[model samples]
Target: MAAASELRSDHALMLAVRDGELDALGELFERHHRPLFGFLYKLTSDRSAAEDITQVVFQRMLKYRHTYRDDGSFTAWMYHLARRCAADHFRRSSQAPHATDPAGLAEHADDRPHAGQHAASRDDHALLRTALSRLEHDDREVLLLARFQELSFAEVADILGCSVGAAKVRAHRALHALRDIYFRLQNPSRASSLE
Candidate 1:
């Protein structure tokens, strides 16, 4: 037989969490925290908020653990919870998602790839972030799910509570929008050259 941890799938670990085995949640956290933090950081540029939201995701997972269904994808369900956590955070705070928190950003640099440490890299990061931020909320979200998170359309549909076809269509539209924004930000005069 495989080792206990080796044999336990994500769902099995989640089921253990649901059964009041809180330690199981730590296992889940170890497995997912990096990606979860990355997704949140992209969603909310404020590193502090992203960290907070990541923690809240797990807290909600534990709070709502009873609702977990064996048939559902654990990661999809976790993302659904994370999306709501972000929505709630945005709703409570008046700042735009791309708004800055300089001190926090400085402190959080080691947690993510260094973006502002060099000139060329800084320009690249700034342009991409600007393009991403210019997208409509739903558009940015769909793009992030498909491109950055690398989730399948079906999993995205589950998280977004939409049909798989709708998810695919949204991602396609979002990518078009992102490309337009990127080119425009790169050079206003050269925007049409991208076509």
Candidate 2:
């Protein structure tokens, strides 16, 4: 039994949550909600939808607490639930592949890219966001998990239920596809650059 004053690990907290400790569940939500929301928002490109999906992840965690394995990583488990929740949301919604994020394309870029680099950098950010929005769901998932979410290939593999090598391959293919889309958007005539 962990003392009340002692810092409990995420895994321990989640286990306690599985055992119906509300405080433990709260702790896990406090630690993880933002990352889950960010990943969902980026993937779905809808703030309200992301917020709803974030709540669903925790709700499902509580609803399916028994499924959580004590030996497994809590973060990975949360992401797995979040991914499922997002999938369900997509099934219920009619959003297009290029669902526009209300936050806009250049939101993540620097306040001002260096003058000489400004045009290119702005184009990069906008086109990249556009390209990402246009990506296939699986490819976008790989990008959000492995790159934006900063999860290692192993963690991503766990969340994705794929082997590490397969996750890496998928991410590689996704990056290639993203690059092709970005270039194709930049110049329609240059689509042959992919070949």
Candidate 1 per-residue C-alpha lDDT over 1-195 given as tens digits, one digit per residue, 9 for 90 to 100? 776865788899999989988888988998888888878877787777889999999999999999999898898888889899999999899655763333344344334565457787766766777677667778888888788878889999998989999999999989999888887868967755633
Clashing pairs in 1: none
Error of 2 at 148 (Å): 1.1
Whole-model lDDT, model 1: 0.81
Which runs in model 1 stand beyond 4 Å of their true positions? 1-3, 99-126, 188-195
Q: Which candidate number has the best TM-score?
A: 1
Q: For every candidate structure, what is the RMSD over all alpha carbons to the true structure, in angstroms? A: 4.5, 4.7
Clash statistics: count for each candidate: 0, 0
What digit string (tens of lDDT, one per residue) describes model 2 on residues 25-113?
A: 88788778877887887788777788899999999999999999968988888889998888888888855445575256344322344
**TM-score for all predictions?**
0.81, 0.79
